[model samples]
Target: MVTRDSAWPGGVPCWVDLGVDDLDRARAFYGELLGWEAPPGSPETGGYSICLKNGRAVAGIGPKQGPPDVPPAWTTYLSVADADETARKISAAGGKLLVEPGDVMDAGRLAIAADPGGAVFGIWQSRAHTGIGLANEPGALCWNENMSRDYEANLAFYRSVFGYDYDDMSANGFRYSVFKVDGNPAGGIGELGADFPADIPPHWMAYFAVADTDAAVAKVTELGGGVLRTPWDTPYGRMAILGDSQGAVFAVIAMPAGG
Candidate 1:
């Protein structure tokens, strides 16, 4: 059983979803690269496909159902007590709501919101579907981040919504904002306002933990995926930027063993 942490809102993040350009191609690449599989769904849930690892739900793969210009990327969702209440808190904290609380068949009720700094994530209320059944595996999502524009606004916004505390860590020559719920690490945030052009959009990026970054990069390429950035050593671990066969970009990190 996964260790229960009282600091986290819902015993750590269960899963994440990606808005991909082409769901079919994304499925193919991930299946080939990670040995993961997914089955198509019913209209009751927008025909979503739950990505699985070792025959258990790990994440999700879906089409770019939002605006046309929105880039295809992976998004992480946090389990919340009530998505409606969380939406209210988000707005009161200076964040904007993209989608109001709505039920997707029996999958669950969910709402999308952006942080005060413009990073987006989902608040989910589970019913029949609790969450991803597996995580932190080689083929499953492992880490999450918000590349935001305003650091102070982001901090204030999340504190009001989730009651989180954070500490700044100077790692790899860049100041990294590490997220903690109550006291345990939840994720990290990075400042990308000036680093990225105005035309570039701000969004949350999910990271998949791989057994070996080098092997994953090579395998991704072999499966028709792209490597936006080559493998490099970060203070936390070795990582590389990878894209699925459908041009949906994400990341893979290999942490040092025995941490």
Candidate 2:
């Protein structure tokens, strides 16, 4: 029953591309820390390098571009069935339309969008590219979270677009508003405060899995990524935030033993 209803091409995530301020520096830093092998790109692939873990595509690397408004950061692209229709629902749901749906030729449709709180993300309608090939793998994206001021709008927009459901239920003193994709447990959506710790913006924060939180936090400093959070516990696992060598912000979660 391979129906088009549940169809998400390339994969659900295909991969995440980091708009790095310095590709050479990021290559060196992440290379040492994550043990990724990034080979040179060709004309067909543009300048983006495909990062491999144990010789498989884990993520991608590309130089940052755009106006002064562009910050060096990682943007998450979620797989959807129809990107144009999803973009329409974004505006109708009170979210901002950042980029209109455009064709990646035969690759599929894509559009950039922001939630009610102005956190930017991309919607990928995969014709050829599905999503990320590897998730929950070391150095790859483990999870993505939307920290927002308006949880209702955030939940509504995503629910309309990807047909996701929110738990909105708390457990063990930690609020776990889990995001589900087509009824499967996905990641999360958390509340954002104005005076939040460490100057975090209302944005989608990606989590990369690491073997050790303490060691990874230490190596973040050694590799030139700045730490925002020390190791902390949750129902999921231990996690921390750090800026990559190129100054793009992201986080890493160290899974607990026997979980």
lDDT of 2 at 60: 72
- Model 2 alpha-carbon miss at residue 155, Å: 1.6
| Candidate 2 segments whose C-alpha is farther than 4 A from its true place | 1-14, 43-46, 171-176, 257-259
Tens digit of per-residue lDDT, candidate 2, span 1-259: 0112233442144447788766767777788878888876665656677787765566678877567668888888877777888888888877787778999657668888888767888888866655565667666777778787776777777776566767776555444488766566667877764456646678888888888888888998987678877789877798888887767888888876643
The model with the greatest lDDT is 1
Task: Report every candidate's CA lDDT.
Answer: 0.75, 0.73
Per-candidate TM equals 0.89, 0.87
lDDT of 2: 0.73
Candidate 1 lDDT, tens digit per residue, 152-210? 67767776787777888745545468888758887877776454667645667788878
